[model samples]
Target: MRPVRGRWLSWLVGIAVALGFAVSALAQDEGYCGDEGVWLQILGSGGSELTDQRSAASYLVWIDDTARLMVDAGSGAALRFDETGADMAGLDAIVFTHLGAATTADLPALLEGSVDAGRKGLLPVFGPSGNDLRPAIGDFVERLIGANGAYSELSSFLTFRNAAGYKLSVREVSATGQRRWSRFSSDVLKLSAIPVHHGGIPALAWRVEIGEYVIVFAGSFSNQRDRVANFAKGADALVVSHAAPEAARGELREYHAIPSQLGRVAARAEARILVLGNRTSRTLGRESQSREAIEQHFTGPLVFANELECWGLPDKEDELP
Candidate 1:
């Protein structure tokens, strides 16, 4: 009995130490979300190019223990997902903005991990409708685990279903200018998607709303800025790819938004915060360029995201609500 009691006390001491270490470590990464709100983490914030400066395109939205949504599965995102050390079973949905290699590359890896963990069927995916968007999701999934899926037999362990929980009914609407709404129950999060420009390919951008907080993710914009601006208006947080800067306006006129232009849109929309993702070396070095441009038009908080970085919604008390 004495020996058993000693072992139990040792276990208790170890647990207390682990808990203390956890709290201290998380102090920098976690914060108040409306006093008791959602927290967002950057699973990966790189662009198409995989460099020390960037990875690819991916963002992980989470609230405490619940994973709300995953946007884009870039080249290295699969590895980062594991590195995030977050709960995968809590991941309710995956939303791809386009079919760019950088965007959908890591999807198979993610799905496989789910299967290994005992997922029984299909997973919910939301994105654009046509060849570039819709077909890509199907092709990728089928290729990965379909009857002819690259790893069909192994893929059989999982299931694919619609937001309504029907397998055959999993219809991906990949139409541009079209909008779809999906609600995440555990966190009461709602997401609305619209096709944005990824070099005119079937790409999409999404606006996610949790309670009163709004987060808009604008994929590579090669099309109408006004169209996306309308969707981003008054957003609580706006994330845009940083492919253009005011200094290089002439070079970027074809497919991207200059930093100032991005800022102007955010200011016009009355967005509370701005996060610049999908950034490149040119834009990164002149990071001040974006700040200057955005400040020229808007005056709000701004963050230049890094790989594996994490952020959270402002406390409700922090807003004018």
Candidate 2:
């Protein structure tokens, strides 16, 4: 579904500033997902709808106390990233599901800020290969920061000619088949992506591996392929973009996972916990129905993720070597 960016975003700055204070206070009081584990932090849990007054789909993967990985920087996500007190420069990589505005609108805003900060580091951006509708991630970045791009003023991101001395390493992956690409692998983290069905739109489902913990970001997907089930098998946490609820129909239902389908996928994947993210107002208002629909198959923990909520992954160090 297309994310509507309207005048509501003008109201976001003030509301976010006020909400940040309350959330920060709550975080200080209750403590966060701990400083020793792999934590899945929801930055923006709302869908493309401007009606919710929430930031669109974005997330962070915190390794220990530092935010090391980011997934999808959607509308208002740049602001949410700032509010979290995260060091944008410390991020190892930023991955996108598809190049929709709901998942990519704030990218240049974020990178521009990083450039201003004079952060010097090569950051890799991983995203899906495009079809006729969308440009591949590489072309997408070139269009934004290439020598003669829309933001040609910030073309240094491509050429690295400026003092900040940072350049984007764009890695475009294909989501055209059953093949799952091993995108990034390091001592602390490993990432893999597989093709997912989002109708004609090229999309991916990411699997993040940190130590013994596994987390899945089922970006934006429909249940027709069930690619996520196998890709996310044995995941400790599965973050599904619940953009459409069980009652949604036609194109709305075709682009996103309905609650019942989500449940079956979670159950099949055997994910330990399911976090429903990228929420729409419709899904938010019908929580009872969605929960019932999901619980029918996935009997494990079900979390209706709220922005800034950090869910810790329990340690399985002993189980791993």
Best by the lDDT measure: 2
RMSD of each: 9.6, 8.3
Clashing pairs in model 2, backbone N/Cα/C closer than 3 A = none
lDDT of each: 0.63, 0.78
- lDDT tens readout by residue for model 1, 165-271: 22311235454554544443434677777666554467677888877778898877754546677888878778888877677655355567778778777888787
Q: Give residue 228's error in model 1 in angstroms.
A: 1.9
Which sections of candidate 2 miss by over 4 Å?
A: 1-30, 116-118, 317-321
Q: Which stretches of candidate 1 lie over 4 Å from their true place?
A: 1-36, 118-122, 131-136, 143-145, 149-171, 178-187, 223-225, 249-253, 319-321
lDDT of 1: 0.63
Across 161-280, the per-residue lDDT of candidate 2 in tens digits comes to 875568888999997988889958866899999989897899999999887789999988996887789889999889898778788899986688899999999999988778888988
How far in Å is the alpha carbon of 105 misplaced in model 1? 1.2
